[model samples]
Target: MTQHVTVGIDGSVQSAAAAEWAAREAHRRGLALRMIHVAGTEADALERELGGGAELPGRVAEICDGIAAAWPGLDVTCEVQPGHPAYTLAAASGRAELLVLGSRGLGGFTGLLVGSVGLRTAARSLAPVVLVRAESGRTDAPAAATSADATSADGAPADAAPGDVVVGVEGDRPCDAVLEFAFERAADLGARLRALESRPTSHDVYTTQAPVEQAEIRESLAAAEQVRLQDALARWQDKFPQVRVEVEVCPWSASRALVEASRGASLVVLGRRTARVPLTGPHLGPVVQSVLHHAHAPVAVVPHH
Candidate 1:
């Protein structure tokens, strides 16, 4: 089947944001956009029909219709599926280029952009899953687009130059899948790629070593970390020559470093390391959980071995 970009919609501010972001992405990739909402029971269906909330299917269709109107030639389609929301979305991820979900700032100031279902869907998704934060007052309309008509072929505001793509990589090893997605996205948008590698906080070179010796050991370790970062990115950099690369060897924690870099980023790419490592399902790591809690931009979690 032809690859497409999919976004899960529930008629919330966050879901609206995800739909717009997904539209732009689909436009950029020259792929069709699929918007889906999962409602499993008669009660759920009745709630949509009567609750009058954003989760209503008709409301979602109205939103999709508006986006399709804005992007004349963009192929936009909406579907209401029947099943467990999380499992349904996770299954949808397997068929699309990537699945996008709205981050309603779930957990408020304490945690995740996505709610419980979103978290489970993201963790279990076969392919990558992107979480988009909802902008206040944002709706089905084109308000989120930059000023000056807020319409462009790439589905972004005309003057809205894309932001840099931030990706986290381990100093000890490289994940080709994650790097590939990051570099490809950078190349597509002509955005810079900021690769981050955090050095562990524990700089315990030795217990009895003098301060000077400890300092030297720290310097040596930092150097090694830098080398590893370079080694990890060398091949990807070559593959995406047009993508400008910036390497950051952070002195802070991995989650903190990535979260900081996420500021104003077009996208933040992370590798999903899990014991199962299967397409069926996998749980999120602690670092991924923390970053999800705090990232300021859309976060892409790519499943990999």
Candidate 2:
């Protein structure tokens, strides 16, 4: 079967944004788009909260229809399944090229961008999961085209120039999958690639020592880190010569740097290690969790060994 882009819809604003983003991605990858809606067991709760009928099938149909009307000629389909939301989406991810979901649900706390379903699905999905926010213009809205009526072949707004794709690098871990995904995306979009590495300030080097000593230690550490970053990216850079890469080494927490980079990025990519135990629950690092909750742009979490 042909691999397609999959997105979970739950009749919320953020989910609608995710669907729009998925449609654009499907067009970019030359793949089909699949929208899956997993109906919850609490029908009454959904009705009371969403102000809909007892069943959610109608809501799902409405969303599908809206997307179809907005972007004509795009191959789009919808499925309504009855099961736990996170598990069903995770199963669907096995067959999808990429899985997209909203950062938060309708009833989540105001401060929480990602809900339990999104968190679990991101950790459990076999494929990369992207959490998109409602205000993400690159995905949720479109940039201006050449002409007022100009649009892409798949009906997305045509951009004069695409934005850069950014990936967070953990120097201590192997991130082949993460780098591959980032490079592929940048190549597909004809955009630039940015590799960001964040290093924490070492107390051992920056303690209450002499200013000269601290400056010397910092310079030595920074030089070493730059060399390591270059070594880590050498292979990937050779593999993707067409991709223009800009590397940065920041002296801050990885999560902070990624969150800051997301402000102007088209997409931010991160990695999650698969749990060794079969029954273990979602395992997300602090950096991934922080970016998922704070990044303004779409965040892609790729699972790696």
Model 1, residue pairs in steric clash: none
Best by TM-score: 1
Note the clash tally of each candidate. 0, 0
Give a tens-digit lDDT track for model 1, residues 137-240: 54445423322376666554443688889999885778888999999999998999999988766745465545567777777777888877888899888888
Worst 10 residues of 1 by lDDT: 139-148
lDDT of 2 by residue, 81-153 (tens): 7679999999999999999998752234545669788888998999999998876233322212212355776
Per-model TM values vs. the true structure: 0.86, 0.85
Q: How close is candidate 2 to the true structure, as a TM-score?
A: 0.85
RMSD to truth, every model: 3.8, 4.7
lDDT for 301 (candidate 2): 98
